[model samples]
Target: MGGEAVQTDITTEHIERLITAAGSHGVTGAIKELGVARTGSIVIDELVFRCEPPRNRHAVPVRIDLVHGTEKAVHVLRLADGEPVTSSEEAPEDACVRLEFDLAELVTLVYGVPRERSAGVHRSELLLAAWPRLTAAYGISDHELMGSVQRAVDSVLGGLSHRRPSLNELAVRYGSDKWSVIHWFTPHYDRHLRDLRNEPVRVLEIGIGGYAEADSGGESLQMWKRYFPRGLVLGVDIVEKHGLDAARLRTVRGDQSDRAFLASIAEQHGPFDVIIDDGSHVNEHVLATFDALFPHLRSGGFYVVEDLWTAYCPGFGGDDENLDNPGTSLGLLKGIIDRIHHEERDGADPDHVARNTVGLHVYHNIAFIQKGVNAEGRIPAWIPRSSDEINPR
Candidate 1:
């Protein structure tokens, strides 16, 4: 033989250990071995890896620079060699050749590295079959590995004042156009709902749209589903939305103003972490739904009323001049503010309002009610009996 090809020795055990540790420290654990070198030159004429669905929206393309030793004959896995793609327009210019993996998929594949492979195999059909076959072959028996990799990527992307994607990003990702729903609404949602981003929550959104047609609505429902990857999104509308049903998403036809019907929906699929009234925009319907459902919200859950401006318009049930209409949804929400400060009144009854109304946030056309027992202890006002007692700290 004129020349011999050096075999690149790699093993599943080493890759698995590296990934396992990366869970705790994020992708930083694997960066030392896998990160692209500061200098661009490399001697190895070997495989290059490029991953997609990058950790951040503004993510630069990442590469690994591996240096294989001729003496050891071991294959070195390095970051891909390329300038980081900084802009969104540049990312998909050549989307076809790029190997994209979500956090779990990449970790699972890394854990199944085979021993002593050729560079040719890496370039062949092996990469295409790697995900399922490798995952099935070596198998990540420990569930922790999957979770670690997911957290690792998220943590790495979310570090050093790098915020997670905003609702606008989710909207763009899922094509929801939630921003058009209300200009200021999505940011407020991101602020309040940040903690529940990754939770396996049950979300109920009222008003599935579609009008009288069975194939019509559920735009916001789709948005909610995409935003909460682990969430179950359910919608209730008066119109039958037979076409919108899918895995993790379900819709029911019902009347928002009917207390019994509303109660039944809750009974069947409630105790929800988030509930949004995006339905009729009718004042009576809004008040009726809140009274029926607010009591059922889980502790620390959120209840959002979108389109509150409808409360001041007669079509939905309000007088533009009189906000004091007891029958109007706006009036009903205003009363809750009184209840929030109920303890401040001289003869206030502690049990008059639900003790769990922790906070109420009002915006241009939205109202966010936070549910939890108001844990702040209060002291009743007392006239000082003596001068020394008046200044008591």
Candidate 2:
């Protein structure tokens, strides 16, 4: 269903101009990339980007679709250097695994990785740009990790987790312990999440930074403001991420872990549809947030906490509740699994305060989540009626 194309002269200026034209609607278009090094042309509609092509030869036109998004998929099309090649044995269409990148400026954006500078353009982009040239541009066929992504599915309900950021990225970010931030991949991320589900959805992103306060109106909130147009959003951070699309968003300031804060949230946005814990990857903070707010989640709603791996390493451990070793969450989730699968045997008791909701899965990826509900699509267990309810497993 997805294919590539060949165009000429795709430049930054051209992209900028087109995006400007997009205004409120945002840019929606596609590009055809090609070449093997200083070879073919990079065309984005009428505009063309001048860049090197691939090395192995052949001028085959690779037709790829920016299917998730036509206008905002500029970042995904970054790999498509425009040069219409007829045929080539190596980079063939049948090749299921492919990694693409812009080769020339690998160092600064990567090695000697620049510390985050809020003053400049969106920091994430600067870093990704320095990545090694030409890496996997689409579909990852990792047999083992598929289940991991599946776990993520049960945790979030709608979001799809792809094996993004290639091997070189792994080596670099994890290798140097470098903080690999992301630049705005606009259309790609938006398009992807949008295409993920047809149902209308809203999300609550918590834990923004101090710099992103209201006085200055931070960029993070602004980014989400535009990204999710149809869906509603509620953001909570220690410091506000300003410029939120107030028309469709609610920005609040409170402790991400405080019960009072959580209650206020429930009162204000009580029962969010999707909650993302992108802030304060701390254990106590995570546990506290989940404990109080999860009950308020809509049935079949999504509750997510990013950076779950922190529960393992001792250095990153925050509070004892986080239970760093096997992850407090893992222990909790495992018990839930036991409760759900082996009910009645070992405290399989199903009497929960928030009864009726189903306990689905456990995972230790970048984030952890609880992603489902009962047949009624409403949280089944408001009150823990079973013995397991008295003592959280």
Best by lDDT: 1
TM-score of 2: 0.42
For model 1, residues 317-343, the per-residue Cα lDDT tens digits are 877988798788778778888777765
* Local lDDT at 30 for model 1: 53
lDDT of 2 by residue, 110-184 (tens): 111123423321112112221222223323234322332233222211111121223233223222111234322
Stretches of model 2 off by over 4 angstroms after superposition: 1-200, 210-227, 242-245, 315-327, 342-346, 351-364, 367-393
Supply candidate 1's per-residue lDDT for 257. 89
- The ten-residue window of minimal lDDT in model 1 covers 38-47
List residue ranges in candidate 1 displaced over 4 A. Answer: 1-165, 173-177, 350-353, 383-393
| Clash count, candidate 2 | 75
**lDDT (0 to 1) per candidate:** 0.56, 0.40
